[model samples]
Target: METLCNNFPSKLTFGHDAKRTLLVGAFALGTYQGVKLTGNFLAGVWKHLLRPGYDLKKRYASDSSECWAVVTGAAMGIGKEYAKQLGRRGFNILAIDKDESEMEKTQAELSRLGIKVKTIIWDFGKISNAESYEAFEKELKNATNGLDIGILVNNAAEFQQESLDMISVDRLFRASSVNSLTPALLARYFIPKMLARYNNGLKSAIINVGTNAAEIQNPRYKFAVYGASKAYLHILSSGMREVWGDKIDIMTAIPRQTKTPMCPVDYCFTATPRAHVNAILSQLGHESETYGTMTHDIEYYMRFGMFGGFVIDNMIQWLNEGESKKLISAYERRMS
Candidate 1:
């Protein structure tokens, strides 16, 4: 290879890497030459591999969106799911999230379910006072212009892992605005519209994404402020259900640790945004999972109550052990 390259025009090999590239190109002109140029060939290939912008095209689904059923946090995790799930049940979806790229991916997934979609990328932080509601109405007026929605899912919430005592007051307010205030504002704004429409024999529903972390006091997940805020969410949902008087369907869901970015990977990622959307749709179709289980309340209690505590206690122990599988098994048997 060196002998043959020595014979090539010297000008073609002016620079360091340029010389090597020219030699390799000459060698590729024949199999005998390529074999003689093993070191150069491999070196050239390796250099190209190391360089960026050599990315392969990813095979993808046809990207599409549904212009109805607006869901917040509609990017990579659970919120990304509303479009797909709702679309399957014959509702168009308006998937909203902070990440436009991921939202497009989710929109494509839902579009496969044959639903039209629209997307909005906006920040929705909550406030404690009545002004929160006004802000939500304004946001709605901005993002959704004359769009009809059979369902609204407020699935977006800000999350982080700083010690509650250490985070500043401004940080605290920011979280309160994201987790508690935004949902409340959205509920306040959307429900009245839903109620007026419901009188015309249309049934509209609202779902507030609640949490299991708020149910316990723990050291590992030091979101004390966030936990306290979630308590307000739980109470607010119950109050809304009571006060709304069945005119608007409201449901609160406490999904276990999902495999979302905000959550640690140690926990199971079952309750995706897609699953939540499906649960809502199933409820709408009048299945046993719908709205309240006034009919199945007795059986649900008998079945889930006993094991729920046991499962929770053991899970807490496992996650606290740094999500170690070995520690979890030991903890489970010990609990048994």
Candidate 2:
């Protein structure tokens, strides 16, 4: 009795008047908020306009001989870039990834910088259930054994674009686990260590890379789980930072589109991984959350500030609906 159409339901609807009124209200709110936020945006620009400044250099100019940084998904893209930049900053790196070959490449590259490079080869996707998570926890403990980790970048993520009904339950589980659970667990594991360093007057930082997908309204194209998981990260970072702000510098790096293997499109706004990582690194200790790229920061303000939340929300809904239809049709054609 199951049909392809049944798996891909029709898009939701709002009558014409309702939608019109909503759009008008959203645009109005956006304009007002945009005007109000312009001041704060300008202030941020003034503060961070200069990069790799004397103060920034001095802050991170520690001997870093005993310091260590742990980067998840360190095999490629943003994670790899983070590892490379951190290594160059004089911190020994613990690079974690399932791709042994890519990790080897990463290790070889970082080794040239003369920093100690240790690799942990493990699949974050295998962690689909409680038992598996426990095993993963143990495995992680063994991998990080005898290491003093000062920085943790919870960057590993699972992104599968599929409709809700069409997606297999197992796929959903994997996406949720890697996107949210892994980061949450890793944060829990490393935060105490960061705090412990506080007594010694040493500072530690935890960076969580978040996505604008969290702000999108009614995410379609099978992005429901991904959006929700990223939203969880931002919320988690905010709350945790409130409680541990004095002890450890917890930051949420909200990145927009960047040129990574994971992203399907390479739009003009899409920042190169190096550019994005460099922007983020330069802002360390200056802000708790950042767009990490100048273009993204402007995009964020325009989308949410000028266009307003309502406009952004409605645009996402419309776009998702269109994309979902195209994807569903393509999938059905393939199946047929």
Best by lDDT: 2
**lDDT, candidate 2, 13-75, per-residue tens:** 899999999999999988887777888688667756854532422343245446678899999
Judge candidate 1 at residue 63 and give its lDDT.
Answer: 21
Model 1 Cα lDDT, one tens digit per residue, 314-334: 564565455434333443454
**TM per prediction:** 0.62, 0.78
How far residue 149's Cα lies from its native spot in candidate 1, in Å, is: 2.1
Worst 10 residues of 2 by lDDT: 53-62
User: How good is model 2 by TM-score?
Assistant: 0.78
Candidate 2 Cα errors over 4 Å, as ranges: 1-41, 51-65, 216-222, 307-336
- How high a TM-score does candidate 1 get? 0.62
Q: CA lDDT, every prediction?
A: 0.59, 0.76
